[model samples]
Target: MALDKSIGVGMIFIASFVFLYYSIWVFILPFINESSFIQQFFLPRDYAIKLPLLLLLLSGLFVGIFVGKVLIKNQQKQKSKKKSQ
Candidate 1:
């Protein structure tokens, strides 16, 4: 259905954005010199990396499952139409 496709697309978009943001926060931030914002946010660097990583993984999984469902539904619809004709 169109709605499924839209939901899938939206989930994928959000997942991608989160993944990119997480990547930047985890990998890129380490190299940047500590600044006011950086110090305030990543102060206890011990667990700061974990939160973004967790979010990235969860969103990635949701995207995969959602897109897979859309694909399967589309396939089923096509098969039914062929059978009906």
Candidate 2:
């Protein structure tokens, strides 16, 4: 599917949430007491680090798509104006 501003923003929004969740789980939670209720949600040892990086990738993808759309739009506008001349 073509990437538009609206869709790109939505993806970034979701990625933000995932990144936040990952941050709280990875950084803050480690300092908390082991017996704390939040420990119950601790991710598996293998996948814990991977999930946050994956979300980071998603956010980057959204930003790239947004930039790509703007660049394409500007190029097309320039081409159209040249054609009209």
Candidate 3:
């Protein structure tokens, strides 16, 4: 559908914008003068590293838990089916 296509395009645009913004904040901002106006728009340099690392760890933990849960549920279903047979 056209709506779905538009939504996908919008999402991609937003993601690209975020990627470029973060890249600039992390890789380029530090070289700029500490007093520049742009510095005010972004958080302290420490967060650029810390935030991504924290997000990565949290996402990994959630994914592992999700996979474990699904596997457990599937095993339970199989056991029940076997018992019924």
Clashing pairs in 1: none
Q: What TM-score would each prediction reach against the true structure?
A: 0.49, 0.53, 0.87
CA deviation > 4 Å runs, candidate 1: 1-44
Is candidate 2 or 3 superior in lDDT? 3
In Å, residue 52's CA in model 1 sits off its true spot by 0.1
- Residue pairs with backbone atoms closer than 3 Å in model 3 (clashes): none
Task: Look at candidate 2 and give me any clashing residue pairs.
Answer: none
Please give the lDDT score for candidate 3. Answer: 0.95
**Residue 1 in candidate 2, Cα distance off native in Å:** 37
Backbone atom clashes (below 3 Å) for every candidate:
0, 0, 0
Superposed on all Cα atoms, model 3 deviates from the true structure by an RMSD in Å of: 1.4
Per-residue lDDT of candidate 3, residues 1-85 (tens digit):
6999999999999999999999999899989999999998998988988999999999999999999999999999999999999
Badly placed stretches (over 4 Å) of model 2 are: 1-24, 27-38
**Candidate 3 residue 51 C-alpha distance from true site, Å:** 0.7
Of the two candidates 1 and 3, the one with more favorable TM-score, higher being better, is 3
lDDT of 1 by residue, 1-85 (tens): 6999999999999999977766676788888878647655544566665776897999999999999999999999999999999
* RMSD in order of candidates: 8.3, 7.5, 1.4
